[model samples]
Target: MKKILFIYFAIISLVLPQSQNESGYAFLKNGFTARNIAMGEFGAVGINDLSALHYNPSYLALNNKTQLAFSHHSLFNDYSSENFGFSFNLFNLPFAIGINTTKIDGIELRTKPGELIAKFNANYFYASLSSAYQIKNFYFGATIKYLYENIYIDDSNGYAFDFGFNYEKFYDNFSLGVVIKNIGNVNELKNIKTKLPLDFQIGINYNYKYDDFEFNPIIGYQNYLTDKISHLHFGTEIKYSQTVSLRLGYVSNYDSKNITTGLGVVFKKFNIDYAYVPIKYGLGDNHILTLIYNF
Candidate 1:
């Protein structure tokens, strides 16, 4: 019995990953997008008009006026999250500023001695300040983030950066965007040094609008520098009557990914959107609800 206990302790000590400088436990995709993880981080091609800061800061540049949005997600049976953002323009300037945050609502934590400690309340909390500048059809922006998290006994705090650009030309029916995220790391864990979940993404969107119908198609790729994970996603959105919208999307990379579908409705200056993510496995099925007030 003593031999078995010693062996177990040895294994747990190595696997506990109590230091930030360690390499195995890695900072991963702990962000706030239900569609992002389910649809392969493909939100750079958003079908709705809220909280585009997840994929590209430049996407929020379209807010000609102040806009605020909130989203809630049931990430599984026990884990959940909430996302909120607000963006606005200034006078006739070509600059914009936005605030974005994602909070991990509930995570249970227990002591290593097998005693139940306290719940994490939030396993991860991230707040970002984003800004953009546009010249003609070209827009560029970036985000600075503050992160705080406590996972079990291993805690890490870090800063991350994101930069992105969007451009369109010719008939203005085609668009392309590029975004790079999490290129820096300043982990305040047990004094070890590591990196963020560095990534690069490029996307294209095209659409046609008429009196009665609007159709949009989007494609994007994300390359994760940490683990060299590259993924592709494709999606389309359709709108009719100018009040209702539907979305369909696909992702490539995993053995099986979710089929993303969503519904949206507009009433005067307010927009309500809901996304259904058909994810099984550890994530289970997820439903996201969003509210946006546009001015």
Candidate 2:
């Protein structure tokens, strides 16, 4: 038992971030869509949905249909985000594009009691171009992004890159994936400079089939360069037929809510998904709604 504990701690020590405030653009760490958020943000691998543009671009190689996806995230403290993504295949290769914007409003700016001054808002925008190719059982992918952030009258912009790879044997029901994200930093507020929330993640997925029911389970680990903690994520989805699914997920080494659940419904080429997450400490809960169209 002692030996196992030591090994676990050693792995954590190697993966955890060195400091909490070491990076900027923290919002980039937020999950992309309702389905991913429902899966406890275990997006390092699996399923290869359109949202893979934000997680593991290598999964793009698995795309068999063109898709467009949109998501709305309702967060606490008057903050919210809107995400849009599209994935398609051209010349036997897959490409994905996405944009995300987060905003916070309703601030009370006052210079004196009972006196209202001016209200201000902050916004963050991210745009990305991603593509993936496969050679036999190995898949490779890359993404390039431009990030812009503004607060009041001040704004800044930067660029970043992500690289990913996936390996699967044609006859196997399991796959492994790895990715490195946010390979660049940002310069904000003229004199303030900070690093992006760089992360390294690795994960695997297993698929089990029992008659007409299908089950997918995923396990992953993520290391952030900006904090002193590592994340362990687990996700599972049970599917009945071609139109319905239930998803459950859990995340360890988190400061807020760690469990997530979601529902998915598909009709023809359209899909709808919803996720419910209860925040800890009564801060507030989060609700994510997503719609996907496949062609």
Candidate No. with top TM-score = 2
Tens-digit lDDT string for candidate 2 (1-295):
0111122223222212334456656678888888878877778778558888999898898765589999999887577899999998888788999999997675445545665556656678999999988888898889999998875566778899999998874347988989999997666543456567889999888888888788889899999855545899999888888678899999888788799999898988889999988888766688999999988
For residues 147-226, could you state the per-residue lDDT of candidate 1 as single tens digits?
66654455667678889888864347888878888766656444445456677888888878888888877888877766
**lDDT over C-alpha atoms for residue 218 of model 2:** 89
Q: What's the CA error at residue 180 for candidate 2, in Å?
A: 0.9
Model 1, stretches more than 4 Å misplaced? 1-41, 45-50, 91-122, 170-172
TM of each candidate vs. truth: 0.79, 0.89
Error of 2 at 253 (Å): 1.5
Q: Model 2, which residues run further than 4 Å from truth?
A: 1-21, 110-116, 169-171
